[model samples]
Target: MLTYLFMGIALLAIGFAVHVLKWNILIAYYNTKPKEKKNNKNTESYRKILGYYGYITGGIFFLLAFLEFQGISVPPTPVTAVFIVWTMIVMYYAQKDDEDEK
Candidate 1:
């Protein structure tokens, strides 16, 4: 369980880094497939949402892992609920901002 938690954290961290750095490796790989070009506004919005989600979820998982390691058990139900609510709030604001920009 601990190993899985760590693995998830690592994956989230990598995803966050990839978004922040705009690493071309993944972009190049994705571009290999023929797809219609997306407008800059849509691309930015997608990146913003992805970056926020990765950062928030990664932090939550790290906190849970740390607490578990320290023998402090948190009820999974409440934590999961809070995470969902928080993610919804974030998405709401992100979408709101996009709407305002338009």
Candidate 2:
């Protein structure tokens, strides 16, 4: 349980570090205008949805971790699965974005 909590915290910390370094692909995608494309509205909506997903996932992990720490036992498998899926999705987007840059 503690390991899962630490892992969740580490993931959130890494995300914050990425934001601080201004290396977040989603943010870049949201702000930069594409030379060939003209639909800013779609990107804007994507950014909003991604932002909400991040907040909601982080909050869920934090809450579950806190509850587990307070003697309320919570299964870690689901949390781990969620984190893994989220990481995979982010990596996919990142690679796709990188390919687009070229």
**Against the hidden reference, what TM-scores do the models get?**
0.64, 0.52
Worst 10 residues of 2 by lDDT: 37-46
Off by over 4 Å in 1: 1-18, 21-37
For each predicted model, how many residue pairs clash, with residues at least 3 apart or on different chains? 0, 0
Superposed by TM-score, candidate 2 places the C-alpha of residue 90 at a distance from the truth, in angstroms, of 1.2
lDDT computed for candidate 2: 0.59
- State which candidate has the highest lDDT: 1
The parts of candidate 2 lying over 4 Å away from their true place are 22-58
Give the Å error, residue 32, model 2: 23
| lDDT, residue 68, candidate 2 | 79
